[model samples]
Target: MGDYDDDTAFLGQTGPYFWTTFFLLNTVFVSTGFNGFYIVFIGASPEHRCLIPEVNLTAAWREAIIPVMSADGRQALSQCRRYKLDVIRNLSEQGLAPGRDVNLTGLEQEGCLDGWSYSKDIYQANIVTEWDLVCDDQWKVPFASSTLFVGYLLGSLISGQLSDRFGRKKIVFISLAAQCVSTIWQSFSQSWRMFCITFLFVGASQISLYISAFVLGTEMFTKTLRVVFTTLGAFLFYCIGYMMLPWIAYGIREWRTLLAVLSATTVVYIPLWWFIPESPRWLITQGRMAEAEAIVRDAARRNGVETPLVIFRRPELQTLHPGKTYTMLDVLRSKNLRCITLMCLVLWMAINVGYFGLSLNTSNLSGNPFMNCFLSAIIEVPAYVMSTWLLKKCARRTLLSTFLVIGGGVLLLIQFIPAHLEYVALALEMAGKFGFTMAFSIVYIYTAEIYPTVLRNVGMGMCSSAARIGSITAPYVIYLGTYDKVLPYILMGSLTIASSVVNFFLPETLNRDLPETLDQMQECQGLCSGPKKKKCVENGGSGHPAKQHEAKSDTA
Candidate 1:
């Protein structure tokens, strides 16, 4: 009923908080639409002609799940051993007939007409050629999966900087529409080369929407709901994907078809491109004071503040706060920042390693790939709801560390559980999922909170880049487990524990101000880096609170 003052007619501009929330929720969900579909696609994307029955040929989708070196001696699946198919195919012109040869690798139509067999590699690839990879050792499955992350890692690095330089709203439209259109092309890809190119573009474009949304939210909202709302945006992203992809996967078994359906949701997000606001903070940072003032006044008028246009010049930069600005070097110049950066990098690594590592091994989670995926995913809904609640009541640092420790503890404990406790291990994995999920959700907010505004995006982006490094490594981590399935968890649990231990030394940030200047950061009490005050005889943190806490403490 109130008069809206957005002259540009931005969609989410000057609306009730719910509409803004709805806007952000849709933004985050669409940004991640490609995730689960990519997972299912990677497994089937290399299948023979994207054939349904040909899904049985790839290491990822093949029915006879066995380790690289070991298979049951008497089992008919002696033909199912990994990497055995390529050895026979080089036999060339001396082709073995289906009726006469023992296919150590499967003959196409194994359960079908018996005499119709050919070289298992050619046969697997021949009938079904569209989406599945024939893993007769002719291709590397882990590397295939790893390539996508390679693309994701590369894409995330520059997407943020690109999004910031361009308008957030403009880039969002470009990335979303481009990715949706690219995905449609993916369904028609005839070769792995084409699939990789399309996936790379999808990964690059999709990654742009997220941090832009986060930055936009931070700038628009009041401090009251900032953390909760920002974190909630991230939480819904995974929760929705977790809830939707598996059900959709079961309904649409063909990976290409499923991707088409998944991409269709993003088409809804296309129209949203015209509506979201240009981040006011970005405008302020770019010295567009006139525009920044306009947006702020528009929101204030809507909120009934009727505030005046104000300009805050840098008095400190002119003389008062000498040596206050930070560069990337400042991140490592102090022992405190160095350790903080390293520890955070490790924590990011462990979470990525564990999350994607376990996730990539979807085949081993259970026999019914679809159901197992569904349960693993659906669990995130309740877990995310609980995380949101805990973030509100609990100290952010404590909650983060506790989740990491618990998630890691469960992973370590799972290794020793007896076979009768398969359910227990699965439960542990889900527990770790919750733990890791909580950790992942908080870290984005946490990282954003901890870094000074000047370095905030770059710092988070670099840290996220490190996280992507772990993402790249994750496929191999889980892939190696195909050689010995338990090894992946052992390594992941160790990494997670190491990450938790690292968190112990990190500066506790509860009820703290976000730092505005180096002096403010250096003077901040009990900062995670090093206890400057504590170093004065009895080591203890003592400094001014970060800028984020300044308004709060004064009121308190």
Candidate 2:
């Protein structure tokens, strides 16, 4: 592959223009983080019970109407069922005064037929309260989250192709506008169905903008900056946005007002279109040398550097394979590529399940939901920083599996923590989040390194799709909490631990030259013959002869 770094070196590594573009493009992640998990607050299920209308009844009788149910070995008022209203009203009118006079449990029970009354202590309004999605309709809450992931799945499928066909800048702005508009539209949703439909659009647009901006920054920056941009810079900005969510949602308890406020913040990004430029690398690929050169020249001028009249070299243009294309089938056809791709899919899926499952389930934790959520988001900062620092020092497979096990193991341990030590459980959950966040960060860099350059994008798209599937399944995992408070932890922990075991089966990628073709791809030597394993170790950990020769040649 030709190095565009050489061709664009005259533009300088850092400058006012570069910093401006970097900050502007990276800020998009803040919005992505904010909007992506807003559902946790928007669809929150506050304390609620059956709505018994104002009737002439004693306070004890009024309280007795809502039956007590045992949950997690503790007594709490049932959200769904109540004593038959007629029976309760008649008893209240009969001058029966105390619980001692009547057996409350013996009374016939019925669903919340009239309606449900919600407590306003935590949230003034949310989808659960506004649409009465409680008891029998409780499934809708998780399904609403699933709807957003469905949109994420759809968006992931098309965003890459769309950005490659159109320009990255166009997709970024268009998706931003769409996200802003759809979010505002969602706040006005009168019905659950409408909210979900608009939310699907929100998911689609939000992810589209995220992916486009990420790619734009990747292509625009030089090699060193590219690593920083991908590894730490963009991710930390995303964490900033994630950290902001709880604070914003904390102040604005109403879901609609929160959505409106989030949408309003996006309007600031509109003027960024003028500041962020189109990717010159992408422009060069499209055979628009004139436009690519113009942009490069402008960058050089901004950086106060001189450039030759002729900027882009012929070899850089030749590097573009406009006629060649690789698909998921191409990745599956090769033995080595298929093994790597399959392992990546499982790893990505498991990491996503653990990561997103914990994120969305923050409300179900045993503390202030706002604080729990903030803790979950804030923990990612150290996780990302640690992962970035370790990327150069640790073997990819070992580092990834160790974090996964640590996360999964901590989550599993949470079940044993006494219920009274709710703070301990919360601390363990944050520890779990820290582990998975590190794994999530490592998997992206690891998966990219594992695949050959030709199929990296396709392989990443496949893994991302698998991740969306996992995210789609995550809400339902949280829904398992209704069955048992510990079920979500048990299931997520088991899956994560099992995935860590699977991680060991794949080859390590640290310090290895990125494979450029199918023949050069590394094989899974975890189960290879002794001789083959020795050869692989001798050749910098590539099992294939072509890769060995390349390693030797580079060493020589």
Candidate 3:
């Protein structure tokens, strides 16, 4: 097949059309960001203790009813247990006072059988407060978050095939509408189970919109612009939305109202359908040359340039196979492609584990929850900016590994900091977040470059599904803090460090042409035989097209 890039080069790198399409598509990330972490505030666990009815007991006795437990070297009132109400009432009736007359510690204790009372200093209402999802039921909170990721996993798997078949623009709007509806549904949920059920749809639709827009941008933009759009344009806008979340939640402390407001804002994006066009590259792939030509001519006209009478060359159209389609299995069937896919899956998973783990754990950190979430979101802006600059200067493999190591190493160092230095701990956490955010942004561009155009969305979708595994596990990692505050950081750091080591095994994609087919795919020259490595070196690390085809046939 003739190269599609050459056919579309006349569109130029910058123009009114390019800028309009770029900004419109990137705006989708903002809404995705808003929904992605909605769980943090909606399911937040506020400080709580057992509910004791103030009936017959004295004020002193009432205060003593909640048992004190030592945790992290400090004493705090027990969240789940309280002194027996009947025993306390009897003791009070017998003219005995707490501590002075009757040793309160020696009295019988029981679970919060009367239910719980939540502190409203941070949140007036949330899932935890609304349903009393604390103590024995606290696992449900993380389970709820995991449920959303399960939807993400499913969405990532399905969105690729659907987008490839239906067209990227169609899927984007469909997902946008679905996300808005699901999020609004979640806000009105009467029960925790109902909320989680709606959250599943929320996750599915949110990720579908995200990946579709991502792929559309990747296909539409020129090579240089691709880097700028992915790193700065897409990610920075998402961070802006992420930063907006805590401030919005801060003002609207009630979870339902906050969710309603966020979901409703998505209605504004519906009109963008007229502004953004279907990817011309995708249209060409489907053999819809006329439609693709029309888009380019329109873009050319918008740029005040004249296009050739015939935009796409005739010979290129003959080589196209509109009926041919590839699936996830195509990548797995080839040994080289399979190896690349496997490594990418693992890398994406590890990156997600560190990225989402640190992100979701913000509430558990040692500062104001809103500030912690805001700092976590805001740090990504510089991270994306630095990554954009470094993508041009550093090798993809080395940069990714370095970022992971830095992120993981700093997180591990948090264990050594004194507990009294909470601000210092927060700083280290932010630094760690900075590292992971950089890695997270880099991995997207890196993975996209590794896969050929025909299988890019399929491969990215597969990797994203693997990432959902990490995201699904992340909330529980944060849940580990229930037992030990430092445990989550320790586990995330160790996994991130190990992932950095695994990254060294993958091939570098810096300064290389985007592979349009499996035959042009780059191999892991760093790990291959000397002769093959020499061949790769001679080809500037883009593996021999003939050998790649032979390898695929051999593996098949």
Candidate 4:
């Protein structure tokens, strides 16, 4: 029945041991961002048109032979179709003026028979150019993006259980290796199917590494630094990796070369396996008392703190859980746990869908795609910093609701902006991105805090699995831009607003001790003792509201 916090108090919460582990943990965090959004560059569609065969035709003849089609409500030359080749050749041979003499508009148009030509302006190569994933095959692009998230969904389910069953440090290295290998292999893919298969592995490694790092950090740090670690430590570095992608893509225009470089760079992290240590909390949970004690003693030595052997000799601390096993059932069977899990699942899905939807939509913004992505990633830095600050000062529920509403409202407003004011639309969209990024950062920490240590990884993983569902749908949401530019924003905005309202029903987690067991969590009875729980105290039973109030004050 003893808490690990008591033992942690002796190790000194902040010290050389902690900082060293934090540094190593963040190395993996940085890599996660690199591959996380590479899909942006790899799947980007460059300007393209049907290839014109060289048949000694004059430029005017070539122009008249290509059919015109409407794209985004504007007339443009068709990318997938052209005039019949024999007709064009005959017209060229006859020297007939196409539209004036021959009435070229009446000629039969056909799909690209000679393949397509891509503009090498922004990207020289990507999956789209390589596979000709345009026109009739356009659906494959979104499906490819969705494949990566499919891997994320699968990985999220298993990583937590594996890490908990094995060790966080081991799973971290394993996933990093998988990600690196899969990324390199993906670059060499000869076909779209091969790329998608490799991407599945890449996606799996991405979420697994993230959860491993997140759970490891959670178990290692005390409550105060935990907020910083989740928001600024893990997430800020992820943004840095994201910001680097456009530059990487800019320098290495070829997808294979770009992927090779990114994958090879991760070799630098292989040595980290030897340096980082397993979590002592996890060690203790497994009844490995001697091993946990040794790590704690070493940490004490590094931190210049002295600890008597008697501290570890306490029977309760030594055998806190001799053979306790927690499963997903523990989370589902209880009323409070079930409510919180369901709410968190919804919150995670909304945050992820909106966040990824806005993030991947950078190409559709008014500015250059590279600069747009760069700025999008840059904006997250301040958003995460503010989120970290707010996590300490604001109630979790309050921040979640407020940020979601602001983000959703901004997205909703973007639809009404005049088309001529593209810059204004972009600015509003960026503001919405900022709001969602803040919410994104908060939700990770919030969800982690809501679950007990035993179920923390599983809980976060399940929530992350829900997030993958949002992510899988995100590309389709962005794909909706092909039909109606503003539709994605409207859909994401409405979902965000609905989720924000649902967030109000969630319990605030600020300044509370994390429950270590399902029973301890059930006892707390769902946000019944927080600063905002005054109404609950008045009612004295499970805090069923007498009246649903819109806003409530919270004291720190």
The top-ranked prediction according to lDDT is 3
TM-score for every candidate vs. truth? 0.76, 0.90, 0.95, 0.92
lDDT of 2 by residue, 1-556 (tens): 2245556777777887788788888888899988989999878889999998888878988888889998878899999999998888888899886478887767899999889999998899899998998888999999999989888877877776677677789999999999999999999998999999998999888878877787678668765465567668778899999999999999999999999999999989988888899987667666678898888888988899988978876553454554345566787676666776777889989999999999998888776899989989989998888888888677788999999999999989998998888889888989999999999888877776676545555666678778889999999998988887788899999999999988887877665565545544667755532344566676666544535665555444
Candidate 4, overall lDDT?
A: 0.82
lDDT for 546 in candidate 1 is: 24
**lDDT per residue (tens digit) for residues 14-106 in model 4:** 888788877778877888889988888888888898898878787888888788888766799888889998888888888888777888678
- Per-residue CA lDDT of model 1 for 27-46, tens digit only, reads 55534744633564235322
What is residue 10's positional error in candidate 1, in angstroms?
22
- Best-to-worst lDDT order: 3, 4, 2, 1
Candidate lDDT scores, in order, read 0.57, 0.81, 0.86, 0.82
TM-score top scorer: 3
Higher-scoring candidate on lDDT, 2 or 4: 4
Q: Is candidate 1 or candidate 2 better by lDDT?
A: 2
lDDT of 3 by residue, 1-556 (tens): 1255556667777888888889989999999889889788878888889999776988888999998999889999999999999999888788888889888778889999889888899998989999999999999999999999999999999999998888999999999999999998998999999988998999999889988899899888877788999999889999999999999999999999998999999989988999999988778768788898899889989988889898777553454466467788798677667777778888888888889988998888777999999999999989999999999778898999999999999999999999999999999999999999999999998988888767888988999999999999999998988788889889989989998887887888776666666666767634432345566655555664434443343223
Q: Candidate 2: minimum summed lDDT over ten consecutive residues — where?
A: 525-534
Candidate 4 clashes between residue pairs 3 or more apart in a chain or in different chains: none
Candidate 1 — what's its lDDT? 0.57
- Give the candidate order by descending TM-score: 3, 4, 2, 1
Report how far off residue 190 is in candidate 3 (Å). 1.4
Output the TM-score of candidate 1.
Answer: 0.76
